[model samples]
Structures are given as structure tokens and as C-alpha cells.
Target: MKIAIIGAGGVGGYFGAKLVKAGHDVHFIARGEHLKAIQNNGLVVKSILGDFRVANLRATEKITEIDQPDLIILGVKAWQIKEIREDIRKVLHKDTVILPLQNGVLAADELSEKIDKRNVLGGLCRIISKIESPGVIHHIGVTPTIVFGELDKSITERISGIDRIFKSAGIESTISEDIEADVWRKFILICVSGLLAVSETTYGELRETKETRQLMIGLLNEIFLLSKKAGVKIESDFVGKAVAFIDTFPPSSTSSLTRDVWDQKPSEIEYQNGSVVKMGEKHGIETPINKFVYSCILPRELKARGLR
Candidate 1:
């Protein structure tokens, strides 16, 4: 399959390397030092699954240079989806499929608004990875898995093709029966952990302090309520499930958003916690905890981007 990876960061870099190793014609779109490094030294993936390198990397910074792709994996930040929508469209064939793996609930809908709904797939990934260096991707956490499906959750030939592609590369993959619900489930996990990590430094601090733990529960409950109000059909006691997952985390663990904040980089605060606040207002649901977390993180996020 001819594939194009739109944002070759940690997610894109790692997955793209795997597909390339599987002998797929994958084109990577990246920028700055990362792109330069991949062009010069190829892409390196140091994964717990095992390490490998792709020396024959086809990488570029310009979207116009890419051929029409059968599939496009969006590995950009949530906030970056709309910004690159048209550029992505420019590289699409009529049947091109776009899968967004960013950490947010609205990725598919956001892309559907800008691109054709037929081309957008609801998707999420389970992995903890980052660019260890300019051209190097390090997979540090769970085995990478891609869970995706049509917005309506129908099993189609294209979806099966994608499943086969990932498995061929030794990447775990699944097609969710209800991708929308799955997306919300992931949103709850990330937002709760990310918000608490942003406010309290680490999961250890949040778990150790009863007050912060209560705040964490409040955040999850509020978001769950909003999801219910929005008619996402989430589990009845999702907060309990979320709290259980939190307890399993390593004490020193911090979310990707918290790590970005510590590194003074721009984050997905607006799409994560901030989205809960915005969606709650839309649905006439009160989300006080999400509002508080969003308010606290916004100023820091803006300052990190020099927009404060």
C-alpha cells in the first residue's frame, strides 16, 4: 500500500518505520531537524519489541511532493489537525483513508468537517513513545496497538486491509465495534491523568495526596457526565474504571501533556481538558472540575507558545 505519514513525530516515526520495514511504500512528511536527520541517516526505531532502522527512508517537508496515498496516518498534535487539513487533502486520492492517532475525542469529527467523511476513520493508539533524538523514535511503554473503525462502525474491506497491514508489520491492531465510545474512553483516561499531572507534577503526587486524588475523581466524573449528556454511551461507572487504571500506573509517571509542559512545549490542553469544558457548555451540562483544570492550564500553555 502507498501510505503517507503527515506528522512524523514520535507516533508517526515509530509506526512509519514499522510499515517501511514491512516493505510498504511509506512517505513521511516532517519538518526541521527531524526531517533532515531522517533524510540523512534514515529513521531509527529503538523499541522494546526490538530495535530496527530504516535506511531507505522516503521523507520530505513539502506535502505537494508526496504521491496520492492509499492511507494517511495523522500523527500530528490534536491542535494541528485543522491547520494541515487542506495540505493533506492535496495528497489524497478519491479512496484515501485518513486515520488520526492523536490524543483527543474529536479528531475524526474535526477531520470530517474539513475533509470528506468517507475518507475519515475514527482511530486511537495505545503506546508511549517519543523522539529520543532527531531521527530516533523510542517506544517506552505498552506494545503499540492501533484501534480504528469507520465512524459508523461497519466492517469494510479497507478497514480489513489496514488491519492486515499492521499485523504484517508485527504491530498489534484491532477494529473497535464502537469507535466513538472507545475514543471517549481514551479521552477520559488521558484527560484525567494529564490534568492531574499538570496540576500535581506526577501521578505519584496525585495518588499519594487524598485531596488531589479527590480532585482527580471529580475531573473524571465531570467529564463522564458531559460524555453522557453528549450521548456517547460510555460505561455507567466509567469513573471507577478510570480510577482503577490510574492506580496501576507507576508512581513517577507523568502524562505526555505534563512532560510537554515541563519541557516548555505547546500541548493539547485546549483539546483535552478544554474540550470537556467547551462540550459541556454546548450540551447544557456543568463541568466545573474540567473548567477549573482548563483555566489553570491555559495560561501556562499560552506562555509556552509565547501567546500569553
Candidate 2:
């Protein structure tokens, strides 16, 4: 299959490298030094699973240079969705399928509204990865599953074909019958964890402290209730499982938001915790913990943008 990975950052770089290693026709769309490094030396992925290189892979900064791909992995940050959507539309034909691996629940819906719903797939990634440097991606966790499926829960031929490609490439993927629930399940943990970790400045700190850990559980409970009200039936022990997972992480481990805040880079807080806050208001649900977390980061976000 001719595959194109938009935003060759951590998620894209890691997954695309795997597919290319399996001898698939993969092209990466990137920019700046990352693009330069891939062009000069190929994309480097350093992981505990294994370290490998894709030397002959095709990469470009412009979308016009590539042909319509069988699959497009939308791995850009949530904030870049609008600009990337416009660029992606230029190369997408009727048969091209878009798999948005961004965080939160709105990405697929927003993209589907712009593109055809039949061509958009809802996906959620479970991995702890980041770009350590130009041309290099670092995988920090063991969970590497990418769950996705059709928005309407149909078992179509395209879903099977994509699943086959992912499996052949050594990726741990599942084609969910109800991808919406899958997306919300991940969101329940990510939104709460991202908020708490960013507010505390470190995941380890939050995990180690009894008070903070209890607060984390509380925030998660609120998110769970909100999800139920939204008509998504999550697993019964979802919060317990999520808490257990967080406890296993390194004490000093921080979320992508904390890293972005420290580096003064743009963040997805507006869509992460901020999204929860908005949902809470809409549903008449009181999300004090989430609200406080969002308030704590709002100033830092504004300062990063020079609005202070």
C-alpha cells in the first residue's frame, strides 16, 4: 500500500519506520531540521522493541509532491489539524483513508466533516514516545497498540486491509467494533493524567504522593461520569486499570504538556483538559479538579504565547 504519514514526529516517525522496514511504500511529510535529517540520513527510531533505520524512505515538506496514498496517518498535534487538513485534502482521492491518531475525541469528527466520513477512521494510540531530536524518536513505554475502526462500527474490507498491513509491519493494532468507546477510554486517562501531571510538574511526584494520587483518582472519576453521561459505556475497571498503569511509571516522568510548557512550545491543553472543562459546563457536571488544573496552565500557556 502507498502510505503517507503527515507530521513525522514521534508517533508518525516510529510507526512509519516499522512499516517501511516491512518493505511497504511509505512516504513521510515533515519540515524544518527533522525533515532535513530524514532527507540526509533517513529516519532513526530508537526503541526497546528494536532499533532500525529506513534509509530509502521518501520524505517531503510539500504535499503536492506525493501521490494519493492508500492510507494517511494524521499524526500532527491537535492544534495543527486545520492547516494539515487543507494540505491533506489536496492529495486525497475518494478511496484514500485517513486515520487520525491525535488525542481527544473531536479530531475524527472534525476531519470527517471536512473530508468524507466514509474515508475517515477513528483511532487512538497507546504509547509513550517523543522526538528526542531531529530525525530521532524515543519510545519510553512498552504499550504500543494503536486501536482503530470505522466510525459507524461496520466491518468493511478497508478496515481488514489496514489491519493486515499493520499486523504485517509488527505493530500491535486492534480494529475495534466500537471505536468511539475506544477513543473515550483512552481520553478518560489521558485527560486526567495530562491535567494532573502538568499541574504537579511531574508524574512521579503525583504518583508518589498519597494526596495527589487520591486527587488523580477523583479527577478520573469525574471524567468517567462525564463519559457515561455522554452515552459511552466504558469498562467497569477502566479507572482502576489506568491508575495502576500510572503508578508503574517512573516517578519523575512528566507528560507532553509539562515538557511543552517548560520548553515554551505550544501545547494541546486547550483540547485536553480544556475540552473536559467545556464538556462539564455543557452537561451541568461539576469538574472542580479539572477546572483547577486548566486554570493553573492557562497562565503558562498565555505566557508562552507572549500574551502576558
Worst 10 residues of 1 by lDDT: 192-201
* Model 1, TM vs. native: 0.94
Best by lDDT: 1
Model 2 lDDT tens row, 63-169: 87779898999888887787678777888888999999988889987886678788899998877788889999888775688899999999899999999999999
- For each candidate, the alpha-carbon lDDT, in order, equals 0.86, 0.84
lDDT of prediction 1? 0.86
- Give stretches of model 2 more than 4 Å off: 306-308
RMSD of 2: 1.5
For all the candidates, what are their Cα RMSDs to the real structure?
1.7, 1.5
> Model 1 Cα displacement at 211 (Å)?
2.7
lDDT of 1 by residue, 1-308 (tens): 89999888889999999999989999999999999999999999998788999986889998889889999999999999888888888878999999999898988888888799999999998777888889999887666889999999899999999999999988899988899999998898788746664576677788778888898888888888888888898879888988887787666667778777667789898889888888888999888888887888788889998997
Model 1: lDDT of residue 86: 84
lDDT of 2 at 105: 84
